[model samples]
Target: MAVQSPSLDDPRVLVDTPAAIVDAIPPYAPRSEREAEFYALGDGQMLLNIGPHHPATHGVLRIVLKIEGERIVDLDPVLGYLHRGVEKLAENADYHHSIAYTDPLEYVSSLFNELAPVMAFERLLDLRVPRRAEYLRVLSCELLRVSSHILFMGFMALDMGGLTPILYSFIERDEMVDMLAALTGQRMLFNYMRIGGVNGDLNHEFLSRLGDWMSRAGRQAEAISTLLNENEIFVKRTRGLGAISRGQALNLGLTGPNLRACGVPFDVRRAHPYSVYPELDFDVVTADEGDTYARYLVRVEEIKQSIRIIDQVLHEMPDGPVMARIPRRITPPPGRAWAAIESPRGQYGCYAMSDGTDQPYRFRIHDPSFVNLQALVPILPGCLIADTMAVNASLDPIMGGVDK
Candidate 1:
């Protein structure tokens, strides 16, 4: 009938008492099994609402945590605060203009977000992409991958209570953005990749900046790695926290750095080579320890791999037209096509169907954030409130992509 709530600051709650707590609190009626279970909390357990507005994702992600003092008992992740019906909007625009609609889905890695649809449309039209254009696509996507990962590293550390990492990360990330802006005409939502080819070629200003940045990019990355790889606070907070086993990663259907951190070599680029990735020389980085620390380390190594990829792309970039010769108005025969890319988050995919019209009959996307966010429900249970934040950042689910 009555109970005293446990204090997180007190040591008594950390250990089990002879009489365990159960079902001493009551509230609103159940909506679903998950909500019913959450509502039926053990004695002393209380529900904590994290946010309908949080920064880990660009827009909003709400998390309802059931906690007994400081330790999390279970959590319910709420999404869909930033969905803009991007796929529905694409169905109305012509092929050339439809690429613009995909830009905002994954704002941090906008180029790859645009590329999947472009490739899918290319498939629908049976268009042959230029050789040089393929290389440029790889180059831009790799750079975007690094930038996205850099933002992840900074914010992941920030979530774990490190301010310096974010500041240092932005300094390097801004330079890469400037280089991309030179090539793509704008910094954020590029809309550069066309159905057959890309919007532009490697220009003088972009190349000049790329060469300079390439010279020290490796060293800059090394410096940041050195800064975080062994810092006592960083290591202590993340080393064994929020660990995902190899089986868990696969069973949860995770991909990208999150899955790779669990030691599965299932990169969409390597597993199913598309674009110019087959031509590039780089190893698929993985870690045996699939914890929050491993996730962070995997992305750091990926930055190096991306840098190597960019260098090779620069040296081997061939001379040719970046845009394919296609009519301004695209009206493909009735057909359906699908294309998937290894986005910073995970496997970013798009499926398009054309019914002999300028616009797609149906356009749909599979954003990795949506799939990857499911892992949190399984992984966050025993974590402390602070550890939950760190784990969320380590997984790096962008609300823009997840909600879209």
Candidate 2:
């Protein structure tokens, strides 16, 4: 009689066979001090895996949760599920073409991705962008900011079991995307900004579309806000749910809206003064609560501020060439340059190193999501398993940027 194999559920039954290889028991062992400390569970405590694939964790992030009863004891976020070696690819490409590689880093706000590298390369080459070009950059970035914030509102609600807000978001978001497509040919990964300027100038079609959008964008946003902001369930679910204190936010290196929500008011635009932001008139939006609800409110208020910026750009946009006089092959001097911009999520920065070559010796990106995701490690503890997604969605990190 042939011996029977162990049950598939029995992970301890290791076998040196092809069938077992397909469905084998993978043994667990601690690889580092952090892992050893986190996995050290006591009686009645268990480890619950959230996702490299769950919707709540968002965009291929694996979070191992240590829970005792209904309360969360600790969590370890396992990253790199979406890493594509973006920096290595940029280092290999020439400076003229290198801007394209950063587009997918924060795919939702590709214009800002292009802006950082373009600004950094301009520094190395010692080039001044045309006045019109600077204004155009601000206009495009502010528009992208509003679009990203609108998407954030939808996702946060959907994560909390509200489906209608996402539908409204898609409706409003598609209109804004179409306006961008009028300016740049691509809808998603737009490699529009070049070394010293944008790929194309604003045309009549783009202007017409933008005008139509401006007329209705604010009204549309308010309509969706009513569905969420006043709802008793939404208010109760999010308010004070994940209160990230100012001290905690600063310690974890949180930036963008997450930082501003905690009453920090540290925007790259206002503090560092990049591009044409100094010329524009707008206030940095902030909230004092430092919780999930406040994060949502901060983004909502920012939408209005971005619209105000766009109005100023349209009125003050000067006449000149959008692109500066630059060579076909850009070769910067032997030095390093850094550029940072206020993106939809936060401060998107790029560091370019040159050794007298058309290609950068080293290209480093400082993505906001990578630093902001740390907020969860400190904020998630002591919250219930049910409140996980509500808190995560409020942070609004793009996994593409985080993994890159």
Quick one: best TM-score, which candidate?
A: 2
Clashing pairs in 1: 22-43
Candidate 1: C-alpha lDDT: 0.86
Write model 1 residue lDDT over 1-404, tens digit each, in one string: 77978887777766644222322223457778877777676888887777776655345888878898999999888777887888778888888787898898888899988999999989988889999999999999998888888888888877777788788788878988899999999999988898889889888999899889887876666766787999999999999988899998999999999999999988999999999888889989999899999999999999999998988998998998988899889999999999999998889999999999899999999999888889989998988987878888888888888988
lDDT of 2 by residue, 1-404 (tens): 98987787666654445452232212577788988888777788878877778876668888778889999988888899999998899899998778888888888888998999899999999999998999888998888888898889989999999999889888878987888888988888888888778888999989999988888767767977999999999999999988988888888888889999999999999999988889889999999899999999999999999999999999999999989989898788899999998887888899989999888999999999888888888888999998889988999988999998
Model 2, global lDDT:
0.87
Off by over 4 Å in 2: 1-29
lDDT at 376, model 1:
88
Local distance difference test values of all predictions, in order: 0.86, 0.87
The candidate 2 region of ten consecutive residues with least summed lDDT is 17-26
